[model samples]
Target: MIIRSATSDDVDAIWELNRQIGQYHFENVPDVFVAPSHLDREFLLAAIMDEHRLFSVAVDEERIVGFISARMDINENIPFVIKRPLCRIGSVVVDEDHRAKGVGKKLMEHCSSWANSNEAYQIRLEVMSFNSKAKSFYESLGFKPQSEIWAK
Candidate 1:
């Protein structure tokens, strides 16, 4: 599989993957994520143009099998607080058929490289508590549990 930066041509594939993951999340946690409102192509396109964002895809046999989108957060407004830049992975998904084949890892490695090149202090991503596999994957990648957000 080949990993590369996302372009407008990959929008359809990215959208489909995003839709599938969104549905999965909604099913896993209906209260946290409503099912109907899914990601749109326009948002993907905008992400491509945003200077602080990084969107990439993994392709095999000329088809997009996975994708990851991340953004840099520069918190400069808080006085007395060091404004260190951070890279946050907003979303990442791999087609079910392509899972466990290293697609997700490749995508994440690319994101980490991008973050490192941009001088980000740290890379952060959020995974739902229900997604044990994903949590395991992140931990294996050297991401330690930082904090938890609980809900009623």
Candidate 2:
């Protein structure tokens, strides 16, 4: 599988990936977060530009099977208390039909290497706490829970 930088041509595919993943979250936890119509969002736009680091299309035989997007952290978020330049995994998605075939793992492995070498000390991401499958998936990949917030 080839992991390469994303370009304008890959936007639609990336958008589709985000849509599928977003909808999956909405269906799983419809009461808290409603999925948005994901067209023309700034976040998506940034992914296609040089402003953020983007890796797309784990391709084989000229077809994209999966993608990953990541960038440097830029907010006062989370309890990691990291005051240095850190990298964040923005989003990573593999086509449902292509999952469990080591595609996602490759994308992540590449992204993690890229981030660590580029001055990102800690790789952090926020997942919906209710998504046990995602939480478990992350944990199996070595992501431990640092903190938790309960909402009433």
Candidate 3:
């Protein structure tokens, strides 16, 4: 498998992955907990242009197998209190068929390396409480919960 930074040509595939991840969340949660509306291609493309963002995809034989989206959160409120930049894992989605094959780890490692090199103090992400598997994966990767948000 090959990993590379996302480009304009990769937008559709990324969008499709976003949709799938949304559906996965919707199915995992109940109807009352609707998934947030996704960003359109134009907005995502603009984000891709940001110097602090690092979106990447893993491909094999010209087929996109997985993707990750992340960026330095310079305005996420945490820095206001902590006085440091935070690198946030905005989104990560590996094709269901591609799970357990280490694509996700490679993507995460890339994100962590980029964050550290860019002066980020810490990396963080949110995993829905229902996503026990993902929470475990994050824990295995040394991400401990810093806080939790409950939607009423």
Candidate 4:
């Protein structure tokens, strides 16, 4: 397996991997997620082209098996809070067949390197409360919850 920065040529493969996770979210959280079809190629391409965002993919035998997208931003300007740069992971998906094989971990490691190079003070990501598998995976990586969102 190899991890590298994504390019325009990787859009299709990345989209397919995104669909895998998108489908899971749509089925498990219908209220907040739409079908994977709603996430069109153009939207993904724009994200890849964004200067503040970094997209990386894991390839195995020349086939893309996973991807992660993250963006660098400053903490919101608030009088009481200290300002700092942070990296927010937007999406991460490993092929269903590739799970538990460290593909996701490699992609995350790549994201961490990118974030550090960009001078980010922290890395943050969100996982739905019901996605226990993802939550556990994140915890295994030393991530602790900072907050939660509640909706009625």
Candidate 5:
């Protein structure tokens, strides 16, 4: 497995990987995740060019198998509190066949290196409450629950 920076050529594969994750979330929480559509492609393209964003892909035999995208987030919307920058994992997805083979871990290690170099104090991501597998994967990486969002 080769982990490297994402290029324009990888966009289509990345989009497909992203769609799989979106489908999973939509299946698990339709209220929070919309069905995958062309609009997501535009959103991802913008993310690729955004200065605060970092995108990487994992390739095997010249095929893109996984990708991770993160952005530096400073909580500017909240007032009256000292704000610290966070490295927020926007999306991290590995192909179903390639999972459990360390692809995700390599992607995250790259993200952590980028975050630390950028002076981000924390790395954060949100997993749907119903996705126990994802929550467990994150927990194994030293992530703990900071808060929960409850809905009726």
Candidate 6:
């Protein structure tokens, strides 16, 4: 498998993967997520073109198997908080058939390298409470929870 920066040509496959994950979220957290549809292709293309962001895809045998999107940003400016650069992962999805085959890990590792190159001090992402499998996958990568958001 090869990991590379995403291009316009990869949008449809990425969108499909996004839909797959989005549906899972919608079902698991209906209060927070709605069924995903009609994603704006132009917006996705814009993300691909954005210099501060990284959108990448994992391909095997000419088929897209996974993707990750991340961006560099500064930690919020608060008097008590130390300022630092961070890479926030916005989304990651692996094709159902490609899970447990290391496609997701490879994609994440690619993003980590990119983040380091950009001088980021840390990497962060959110996994819903219901997704134990994803949580385990991330934990195995050495990620630790830094905060939690509680809802009524």
* lDDT (Cα, tens digit) per residue for candidate 6, span 15-87: 8888889899999999999898775466677888887799999999999989899998885868797578889
* Lowest lDDT 10-residue stretch of candidate 2: 36-45
Please list the Cα RMSD from the true structure of every candidate, rounded to 1 decimal place.
Answer: 1.6, 2.9, 2.7, 1.2, 1.5, 1.2
How many pairs of residues collide in each model? 0, 0, 0, 0, 0, 0
- Candidate 1 local Cα displacement, residue 123, angstroms: 0.4
lDDT of 4 by residue, 55-127 (tens): 8889999999999999988858687865888899999899999999999899999999999998888999999
Give each model's whole-structure lDDT. Answer: 0.88, 0.76, 0.82, 0.90, 0.88, 0.90
Tens digit of per-residue lDDT, candidate 1, span 8-94: 878888888888888888999987887735446678778866766898999999999999999988888889866998999999899
Worst 10-residue lDDT window, candidate 3: 31-40
TM-score result, candidate 3: 0.85
In model 4, which runs have C-alpha deviations exceeding 4 angstroms?
none
Model 2 misplacement above 4 A: 36-43, 74-80
Two-way lDDT contest, 2 vs 4, winner: 4
Among all candidates shown, the one with the greatest lDDT: 4
Q: Give the TM-scores of the predictions, in the order they appear.
A: 0.92, 0.82, 0.85, 0.95, 0.92, 0.95
Where is model 4 poorest over a 10-residue stretch in terms of lDDT?
73-82
